[model samples]
Target chain A: MSTTGTAWTPERRARAALTFICEPGRPDLSRFVAEQGAPDVVEALLASSGTAAWSRRARCLDLDALIARAEALGARLVVPGDDEWPAPLAELDRIEPVGGMCGAPLALWVAGRRRLDEILRPGYGALAIVGARACTRYGQALATDLASRLAGQFPVISGGAYGIDIAAHRGALAAGAPTVAVMAGGLDEWYPKGNTRVFEQILDEWAVVSELPPGMRPTRPGFLARNRLIAALSAGVLVVEAAMRSGAVNTAHWAGALGRIVMAVPGPVTSGMSETPHRLIRDHEAELVAGPADVRALLCAPGEQLEGPWMTPTRPLDGLDPRLLAVREALPGRGSLTVDQLASRARCTSAACDGALVELELLGLVEQDESGRWRLRRPR
Target chain B: MSTTGTAWTPERRARAALTFICEPGRPDLSRFVAEQGAPDVVEALLASSGTAAWSRRARCLDLDALIARAEALGARLVVPGDDEWPAPLAELDRIEPVGGMCGAPLALWVAGRRRLDEILRPGYGALAIVGARACTRYGQALATDLASRLAGQFPVISGGAYGIDIAAHRGALAAGAPTVAVMAGGLDEWYPKGNTRVFEQILDEWAVVSELPPGMRPTRPGFLARNRLIAALSAGVLVVEAAMRSGAVNTAHWAGALGRIVMAVPGPVTSGMSETPHRLIRDHEAELVAGPADVRALLCAPGEQLEGPWMTPTRPLDGLDPRLLAVREALPGRGSLTVDQLASRARCTSAACDGALVELELLGLVEQDESGRWRLRRPR
Candidate 1:
């Protein structure tokens, strides 16, 4: 266990202890974690339980040792104070001390090409794609499309799992966008071994991360626990395809809890793989996203469209020209005001008003009847 | 043409006119209708623009004549004010009027053994089954399963088209929940003609509704328009199977807009037809639904738990001792309290406090740790 970096401090011990108790209740882990962070209690538990064997197990999996394992591989340990820390993650601690799969990472072990702080800064597009381990072609294709296109635009975050998640990572990697895989087990072992090549490829070009210490084996619960971190770290979560009961649904729940946008793609009626995402949308728990435009709405920074859709330059009022702003302002109420009435009120000669009206009409502020009566056009 | 009862009055004409304007861009037609109601407007438009004479080519079809045609077959027109109007349709007035492939109907014409309105109510359990006109065997099978079994609980709403929709209708008819075929054309011309027998069977026992007038052919647009009414009039919309751009996608979209629950049965990843619903879920636009339980959530009246998952009831509190109350009061503000700490504040014997705390824990108000700590639980 002696690889690199400093030894585990008492505070670091508490973080490891807290996460162990964070498991679905020995009926009281939350209270204990709340009173004193889990790591703090782990120190006490080992001392008070008076079990020498248990204390040895705890010391064997020390945070410093865990950090050193990654450090030996040229990785950096990012605690809450690091500039690279994601602010959205810290928000998770306020609720239930640490909750769901989306909890703030106690410490992140990063060995990658892209910098975490760079992506976290405004303007870098990052999306998380997660779904059923068993997915339909629809899910795979969409996951690939999103990952490829989004990675070209921004980095993509996801768990290094199978099916939809794997496709998302592969898609982004192929498109040359930075991709990150958050694992449930230690980086030493990529679960499903088949994805090891992809996991390696991602680490070579981007980053592959894990909250767990080295040598820890994967379990069903650990995978469930991994979903929250996936949701918490991304700007939004896109469920590719999943069973109604899949962990992707858990990711969606975590995203919603974090106030992060949750989006799901739809599938054909016959695909069992699409159930999880469909359930979220049908319940109004998530938005129906058909394309990247929908995801853009959920994002924080602006893209493209600078002048905005509504803003227009003011026209000259002095001109006798009807194609200017004078005719538009001359209209009485927002309701259907007739053009002829506007001309009369604006004191513009009928011919001038008519010309101005056409220009205003081009600007989309007024409309006319089939019979040629003029009226104010309501903005859509 | 003989209707059950109608000589014509201002109110009936107003109701019919209201239905007409509910369609997109038809709001302009509202003023003309309001200025003259139905019969008078029809007569006025005819005289003023020679609207009827120009329509001899058949594009500007008369809606009243559509009603008159249904009446000739012993069917009556049902409007929002009608006793047979489906109440679920009330949602149409709230949203920004959904349109296209799945647009809502303005007036429904019915010739049926079962009342349309009674069959669509949530408590009665109506499920909408729709999909691509061309469907895979998997889709067809799921449609049948949904229609056949869920029919025992409620009526199945579907477009009386080919493939998946037809299969669902057949399943419901076989199950005896009383199915309704929302058509794209009038009852006189079954359009697809291949479905003529099923159309006729439904005419005698169920309903076939369309916003399109009688004698007017079912155009592609007409089919798109008819899909929405199917969505709005049902407790939930279920897409058994669909391609990326299939008609079932339209039905799902309408369901989302109407705020009615939209569910899609899952299928295999290999099928291309699974794309749309899978996309719906991935995009967070629809729910992944399986069997009757998923449908039941949509049909569940506000507060009644109907079958399966998330239906656990509150634990009861029949007995509470004072020591437990004191300990509960001593718990930290959104904080975790230990068992030993709780005992110190209770002003009672540690044994009594521990006993009281255990009962409180079982009742779910307070939770404790494996390390013998206790704390308040969040309300959720």
Candidate 2:
């Protein structure tokens, strides 16, 4: 019989065949495979003493068709000993089960121009940006901005779905950076047809990955299994926005159980989209990150400062005279105001307010409009 | 010599006199007063041994005039060992100085019908709400709502300034509960003038307190000293909204220094007004409180649940099937959508979407308009 490629050793073939018959994230099956080896586990499942369901699926599987489908999609199966396997996934073997699901994927079907191993090596790691599929505009904008800014340094990774996930993918593409799309089903058909364009763009530069074989549709259990893979493949996971009950929260759970840095961006407490992020932060289960700088701060080694423009404590109005500060605060956020109006609002004399405006203008903190009204200068 | 009232002992008079000549928060002076006693300290300052600034101010002091001024304002002095002095202020005596300011006031000038001691006794501790004077409508609204909800159980404490401070004071009064306004200047005249009406209302029910005498005006340093008193008088400090450099941040520092629970409400990250609160929450320096219930949770003894409607983890969408959840999430936040639109958005077939919608409708998670378009039910 013809094989998929020279890289398809007996071990690789066994792992690939197991993906078709055995479900992913089964801790007991994973343990059995780990101790006895994939080939031996497959042999046991095919024997008379094996579970009826596993034996039936094992016997009916068509290996040749699976191999041909993988090749047709430009995907390759990577097993435990392959050079392309992610080192971070090793953590999955040691972590406790979540929702009765645990263990590293038996083999991942990966397709891309770049290697997964190189993308997730030490010093250069991936960050997973996951959130609700029905995200708000604020959440989408923030996720896109954060991903675009960080993708050039660390490749962005996310599920191939809409809302925050698609936005993150588009952001990386906008920045001309590579990004990975970890799908919940067979990557041959990027599940959400709406984001197929984004998936295609990602596949051109980075990769589309999954644990399932071709021709399989995504199930609810498959989605849970996919979240674990996303978490295990990244150094840290940043939850942009999520509801009280969301898949993003589940991904965060997996990240936490894997000992990965779990960070969340805060939005208005008034928004339902902020529920999961706020809950994570309030419970101390995740670090609060306002932007990319905060994410960098937590991901970096201890004692290293998060170096960015925002890291500086030098605010424009810091250390201003109390009178000047009061005058500045009195000015409305949008419109300009006359000295008299400012003084009335600031509760100071008009002369003092005028003097403060002059000083503030000199310091580049305020400006005079054509109408002779003073306003705060926009900060650079 | 004529005295303010029977409560004005020689020791009380000495403490009262010190307020006229000395600034409120001098760590060294506070240590001196603590050790030497207020009467001896006054005599020493009156003698040639006093510093030039202290001696000049002390020598010209007229006891009868001060006493008469106190009675005319309907205010009285509450010295250490007095029944009306807040026991929480004792914490200030043991805490380290922040920015060269420390220790409790020698005596507080207070005005109101309720005894300060009774209001701040063990069971009925106060919460301080502080923020920017030029706060956003969001901040002001949140402050008002939080204070109104919490004041019935806990007397609200705040500064008598224009924005968040006055809003908090007004909210407490709206609840028909007594609230304290800690002033930077003297209680006899509330500064800023814009908030005098609110201050007058507070005096009718609660109290206005300060360390300065009747003739003193608020200076920059006096504002810093006033922050410590607000922190010292409360069980916790809730910063509603503040810029990066704000007096509210200063109060949070005092609260932290005094080991008081420091909590902050989160707003939109796009707003500059949220800077201080976001920073405090990100650095783990302050707990994030979305509402009064969160405040109650932190203030309660460890392990006690924050008992409120929000405390229940039974969300409307909890334990929902994946198909129904997807359909629910697909419905637009505001408007209704056709079945085809939802099915397309949820990446499900029209038949499956229709079935899921029926289940969701039965569960009261979604509703259909007269047009037969489905929409998510607004969470109550």
For the candidates in turn, chain A alone yields TM-scores of 0.68, 0.77
Each model's DockQ score: 0.19, 0.47
DockQ for model 1?
0.19
Of the native A-B interface contacts, what share survives in model 1?
Answer: 0.39
lDDT (Cα, tens digit) per residue for candidate 2, span A1-380: 11225466677788889998988898866667778888887787787555588788888888888988988888888777678878678778898999999988888888877777656656666889999999999999998998888776567899977889889988878877768898888867678998887888777777788999987789999999999999988879999999999999999999999998999888887889999998898988998888776776677666443222212233565335677789999988898999999999999999999999999899898998999998889988
Mark the regions of model 1 whose C-alpha exceeds 4 Å error after superposition: A1-71, A97-104, A119-125, A134-141, A190-192, A213-225, A244-246, A268-272, A290-293, A300-380, B1-143, B157-159, B163-165, B181-188, B203-292, B303-380
Model 2 stretches astray by more than 4 angstroms? A1-6, A47-51, A303-380, B1-5, B49-51, B303-380
> Each candidate's chain B TM-score?
0.69, 0.78
Model 2 agreement with the true structure over B1-380: per-residue lDDT tens digits: 11235567778889889999898898767667878988898898788654599888899999779877987888898887777878778788788789989988888998876778756766555789999998999999999988888876667899888899999999889877668999999776679898888888888777888899887899999999999999999889999899999999999999999988999988878788899998999999999888776887888765543222111223566435667888999988899999999999999999999999999998889999999999888867
Which candidate number would show the highest lDDT if scored against the true structure? Answer: 2
